[model samples]
Target: MATQYDRIEPPLARFIARQNIFFTATATGDSRINLSPRSTDALRVLDDNRVCYLDLTGSGSETSAHLLADGRMTIMLCSFQGPPMILRLYGRARSLFHGTPEYAERLAASYDGEAPLGARQIVELTADLVQTSCGYAVPLFSHEGERDVLTRWAMGKGAEGLVAYRAEKNAVSLDGLPTGMPA
Candidate 1:
């Protein structure tokens, strides 16, 4: 059975905090829908109605592009090693790029000066609906650890190199949408 909630309850918060990975889903009016798996301790719940996640540089910037076109997003998390539950956060979101004032403030407060290299955007979500369903069929898996490949690559390239790589790979989505990337 599924249950809907007006806000993120205490139990849901506990469930969210224990998850190793979460998925984000988004789509524009005409473009393809995108579902992305994200990790790296990037998510934070600001309040009952608001949440934010840091967007690291990757091969594609579909989420940023899609959110720019349409603010809708759904973030989902499932218990893989405990009691069965699937939580979904449905909301509108906007992406704040590195050059923006909001980005600076967020970084200063949350990351100080040690923000991740090649950081692209921060996605802020305003939740309007929260739901949970029985995830009895969800497979149980143990979390090993975070992958170091991306961090190592970014460290090797440094800042300027990362900017160039973003230009080459993260500037646009496969459907030719602008990712709000700085030039």
Candidate 2:
């Protein structure tokens, strides 16, 4: 029912590219685990063992904080459109801040040199393990499309407003951990 691999094979990469949403799970030694559902075209499979996703401006930056406190991260995707399958990538992750050369390079390579509006950082993960399981119990759902609310909100907030908003809301996690976004 389950199998493990050292890296993401080509077929797995294709499966990931077709996924409309994925989940990220992370935590520190003493902090609550953070699990989030991410959508849009923000994620990219950089290589057989590396992946990156554009971190957008959200209400909280728990993933960023957890990654900073403890590098362990896991990304999971379940098949909803076709045959039942589940994939998980276990790895260490780091957030690449804007203005850094790493961030710029990732943005260019993964995002076609255009950073989406309200994008604050890039979360890159280097996988040590990949696992696949039969998602027999998973229910099927069709991906209608990406929502534009985030984009519209970012547009309304503009650049300066987003900066201020992040400073106020994204700088700290719910457990009082610093996300290193800016305070």
Candidate 3:
């Protein structure tokens, strides 16, 4: 069975707050659907109908591009260690670049050390529907803290290296759409 809400209720918001990770999905016309496993600590539930996440510099900017073109995005979070449940947020999302005021405001209030090396943009989402279902098939695995490999790599790169890396890998989507990434 599944349940849906026009806005995130107290219990639903609590569940979202307890999760350590979330997944994001997006796509555009004729472009490849992008599903990224972003189990970061940067997501925040803003009130009952909004959520935001800090998207790091990755190899592809599909999410950014798709959001720009279509404004469609879905974020999913599953209980990996506790009860078996899956929460999905369907919404319209907008990507805020680093130099923009919106990005700065949201990033400042998001999390400590969120704007780190290789930081790219913050995705602000206005969720239209919140759904939860029994995740019977979801395998449970205890979290052992976030992996430091990516963090270490980004730290090693420093700010200058990160800028170069973004230029080479994250400037465009797989289908050649501009991701609105800051240069």
Model 3, span 1-183: residue lDDT tens: 999989989998888888888899999977899998886578888889998888787777899889988889999999887888999999999999876888888877776535777678889899999999999899988778887778788899888888889888888899988888777
Error of 3 at 144 (Å): 1.2
Please give, for residues 58-109, the per-residue lDDT of candidate 2 as tens digits.
9999998998899999999999989899999999999997767888998888
Local distance difference test, each candidate: 0.88, 0.92, 0.86
**Candidate 3, superposed: residue stretches over 4 Å from native:** 112-114
**lDDT ranking from best candidate downward:** 2, 1, 3
| Candidate 1 TM-score to native | 0.95
lDDT of 1 by residue, 1-183 (tens): 999988888888888989999999999988999999998288888789878888888889999889888889999999999899999999999998877899988777666634688687888888899999999999999999999898898899998888888889988898999988776
The order by descending TM-score is 2, 1, 3
Model 3, position 99, has a per-residue lDDT of: 69
Worst 10 residues of 2 by lDDT: 97-106
lDDT of 1 at 108: 73
